[model samples]
Target: MNAREVMLTIPVVLAPDDTVAAAVHKASASDLDILPVADATGRFLGAVSKADLVRHAHDPDARVGQLDSADILVCHPDHPLERLDHDPMSSVPHRTVVVVDEHGRLCGMVPWVNWAVDEARTQSGHPRSPMEVRTLSMHLHWRCLDCGYLSARAEGTPVRCPHCGAEQSAFALHTED
Candidate 1:
């Protein structure tokens, strides 16, 4: 599967200008230790770790924009998870990957589990569908608000609109009574 298929929408995000205190509050709502940072128009900037937020929590005025972003891992939506040419995440402490659209807008976050799955698949020389490769055990049907595309995704987690590349806010669970 491609990065887009395996990536998950990071529900909580920080704007570059957000204060360190505010970032700490936002990060608390998420299960991930690292949070993606995006701009007003949804362009990806970087990420701030939970530890970084805590370290700077004493300085509420400190802007998240000041956080060093040189080590963030970046990849396109269509990038194949099966193989990567340049995986700088090998050295990145967070090791989380940020998936971006063609215009460099934030698409979603790829958990390290995907890489582990790839490793097993490669070792076994077995090819499986995205669902088979995914670690999430549950899924639900969803529809993109920006476009009419509908599909199933891991339950409760958001995802980038595969068809129109709309951000997570534009998606809604679809159910029929």
Candidate 2:
């Protein structure tokens, strides 16, 4: 699957004119350590990180663009995740890679953890599980019959439901379509 297909679509974005304090607030609210910075035209500019904001805490009034890192890794939506390689020389340790469109507009963010998971899954010789394949293809949702807890993840039924602690048999797959 492509990076776009698995990327987080609703990423927290910071505007270039926004303040360092604003970036910190947004990052904290979103539980993200880093946030993508975009221009007024919705074009991807760079990223502001929690560490950077903390480093510039004395200057909270500074614009995010002034403190944002321009050396962020960016990939196209259609880029193959398998072909992505980590750059050891990256200026900032990246938790997520920015995904942009042909026009350089921000689309989504792909977390490194997702890539690690995919790599492990592939190396296990199990390929993609039926639930994973179905969810990726059809965007199916898995529901816990015992507690009615729903999840969009396609990793198949867990040994126990996260919500009700019910057995794996309590989970059923359903699609909105």
Candidate 3:
């Protein structure tokens, strides 16, 4: 299926100017992995996950625009879901995949799954059980050498820099205290 067919149309969004408190308040009322952030003109800026926001909630006055971002999978509405599987470099994305139009305006979101890596498992004759497919994840720290961006994910393997779009080869394991 294409992304459009699997997307959830969300009417609410957070603006970059919104405060961290605002993001936390709004996210508290939603069940999405990453809340969509858009501009006044409706251009997709980035996203803020509830987990990430909660960590930064101490700085209640911080602007959402200034938040550090992790790599998010992005695709056009017409992007075939199966395309992610063919690309071996793709990490198993379990966050929200933002769907944008040609103009980079937010269209909707397709909640990503572990299908990429699961497919690999299937190919290796050890397919994941339904429960195992959604098992607990490890939060890892990854630093992007290209842009010096550091991000942590409790879901899939991080393979790129969220700030600069660097490839997996450009990343190094980072440790956070």
Candidate 4:
């Protein structure tokens, strides 16, 4: 199935300028790990997690700032979902990526599970657990050789980096336990 066929049509989101308190309310109400952050025009900015706020809860000043990811990790809505790597043990089960338009407008989410289930439905002509349908993700886990930051520019294929641009292949892959 195509990405558009399995994409999440409506996703709850918050504004970038929204306060931590507001974000807390939304996440609590939804009972989800992460919430998408949008701009005034409903353009996706980034994601804010409950853990993110809790990490800074001790610091009373943390909530005063934007409730958005400092460095946003995003994916296209039209991309294939079977290409994601999901760790079931992780707190957030989101192999799904937040999708945005070319102009950066919030569109929808394409979850890895949806792809599997949809594919199973197509191949088997019946519903099958997404877990049973497996697809190995080819994404390279890149890390900054200098500072130890995970490179978010896809798994492989070198490109001019923004962190420490020393050619394209400077950063190496980093996998965490």
Q: Name the top lDDT candidate.
A: 1
Worst 10 residues of 1 by lDDT: 131-140
lDDT of each: 0.66, 0.63, 0.66, 0.52
Residue pairs in steric clash, candidate 2? Answer: none
Query: Which numbered prediction scores highest in TM-score against the true structure?
Result: 1
TM-scores of all predicted structures: 0.62, 0.60, 0.62, 0.51
lDDT of 2 by residue, 5-31 (tens): 777874578998888767655654453
- The candidates, ranked best first by lDDT, are 1, 3, 2, 4
Higher-TM-score candidate of 1 and 4 = 1
* Candidate 4 lDDT tens digits, 79-145: 5544444444455333446667778887876545534434635564654555544443433355444
Instruction: Go through the candidates in order and give the C-alpha RMSD of each one to the true structure.
Output: 12.2, 12.1, 11.8, 14.2
**How well is each residue in 28-140 modelled by candidate 3, as lDDT tens digits?**
44545567889999999998765577678678899999987645678888876656433333353365578899999999986544544345456657645674354322434
- What C-alpha lDDT, on a 0 to 100 scale, does residue 21 get in candidate 4? 54
Q: Over the stretch 43-129, how does candidate 1's per-residue lDDT look in tens digits? A: 988887665676676788999999876344678888876564433234332256788999989999875644544654666586654
